[model samples]
Target: MKTAICYYSRHHGNTRKVLEAMAGEGDIDLIDVTTRQVVRLEAYDCIGFASGIYGFEFHKGVVSFARQYLPEGKPVFFVYTYGGARGNGAKTMEALAREKGCLVLGEFSCKGYDTFGPFKLVGGLSKGHPDAQDLEDARRFYRDLVKRFSGGAQA
Candidate 1:
C-alpha cells in the first residue's frame, strides 16, 4: 500500500525522529507540512498525520491541512509526541479525521524531549526520549499498520 505521512516537527525534531525510524522500514513518504502547504493525498491507500503536540493538540498546520486537503473516506492514522502524558493525545486529530469522513485506523504516541513553557526553566522533560527504544516501538507500530492495511487493499 502506498502510504504518506504529513507532518510538522519543530523545536527539537523529536516527532521527526520517530517518523524517520518508520520510514526507514521503506516505502513511506514523509511530507513536511511547513514546507509543503498543499499535497495530493488521493493516491495513498493510507495517510498519517504527525506532529509534536502543542498546547496538548496536534499542530495547527496539520489540523488546517487535514481540514483543507484530506480526502474524504480515506484511512487515517496519527503520530504525536508530547512532553506530558495525557489520557488521549490524538483525540482532537481523530475527531477531525472522522469529521472529514475518514476511517480512523490507529495512533502511536511517545514522550518527546520537551522544554516548552515551564518545563524550559528546569531544562526539559523526557530528555533523550523518543529514544532508540521508542523509535523501535514506532517502527513496529507502523509495520503492523502496514500489514493490516495491505491485506485490506489487496482484498
Candidate 2:
C-alpha cells in the first residue's frame, strides 16, 4: 500500500524523530505540513497524522492540514508526542479524521522533551524523551499498522 505521513514537528522535533525511525523500518512518505500545505491524499491507501502536543492537542498546523486535505473513507493512523503523560492530542485528531469520513486504524503516543511556557523555567518536562526506546517503539507501531492494513482490513 502507498502510505503517507503528514506531520508537523516544531520546537525540539520530537515527532520527527519518531517518524524517521518508522521510515527506517519500511517505505513511507513523510510530508511536512509546515513546508507543504497542499498534498493529494487520493493516491495513498494509508495515511498518518503526526505532531507534538501543544496545549493538550495536536499542533494546529497538522489539524488544519488534515481538515483541508484528508480524503473521505481513507484508512488513517496517528502518532504524537507530548510532554505530559496524559493528553488528548490523538483523540482530537481522530475526531477530525472521522468527521471527514476516514477510518481510524490506531494511535501511538510518547513523551517528548518539552520546554514550552512554564516548563522552560524548570528546564523542561520529560527531558531526554522520545529517546531511543521511544523511537524503536514507534517503529514497531508502524510495522504493526502496515501488517494490519495489508491484511485486507477495511476502514
Candidate 3:
C-alpha cells in the first residue's frame, strides 16, 4: 500500500524517530507538516496523521492540514507521541477525519520527550523517550494497522 504520514515533531524529534522506523519497514512517505502546509493525500492508499502532543492535543499544524486537505472516503489513521502517560490523544484528528467522511483506521500513541514550558527548567518529562522499545512498538503498530485495513479501501 502507498502510505503517507504527515507529522509535526518539535522539541526532541521524538515522534519523528518512531515514524522513521515505521517508514523503514516499507515504502512509506513521511511528510513533515511543520514544513509543508498542504499535501496531496488523494494519491495514497492510507493516510496517517501524526504529531507530538502539546497541551494534551495534537500540534496545530497537523490539525490545520487535516481539516483542509484530508480526502473523503480514504482510510485515515493517527500516530501521536505524548509526554504524559494518559489521554486518548488523537480524538481531535479522528473527529475531523470522520467529519470529512473518511474511514477511521484507528490510532497508536506513545510517550515522547517533552520540555515545553516549565519542564524545560526541570529538564524534561519522558526524557529518553521514543526509546528503542517505543520505536519497535510504533513499527508494530503501523504493520498491524495496515493488515487490519488491508481488505478494505474504506470502513
- 21-80: candidate 1 lDDT, tens digit per residue: 999875889999878655899988889999888887888898888887789889999999
Give residue 153's error in model 2 in angstroms: 2.0
- Between candidates 1 and 2, the one scoring higher on lDDT is 2
Compute each candidate's TM-score over C-alphas: 0.93, 0.94, 0.92
- For model 2, residues 7-85, the per-residue Cα lDDT tens digits are 9998999999999999887778999998865589999888999999888888899999998889988999999999975
Deviating ranges (above 4 Å) for candidate 1 = 153-155
**Count of clashes in candidate 3:** 0
Instruction: Supply every candidate's count of residue pairs whose N, Cα or C atoms clash at under 3 angstroms.
Output: 0, 0, 0
Task: Compose the digit string of candidate 3's lDDT tens values, residues 3-116.
Answer: 999899887888889899999877799998767555788999989999888778888899998887788878888999988654658989988987888888888788888888
- List of clashing residue pairs for candidate 1: none
Q: What lDDT does candidate 2 reach at residue 102?
A: 84
**Order of models, best lDDT first:** 2, 1, 3
Worst 10 residues of 2 by lDDT: 84-93
Task: Note the Cα lDDT for every prediction shown.
Answer: 0.88, 0.88, 0.84
Best by TM-score: 2
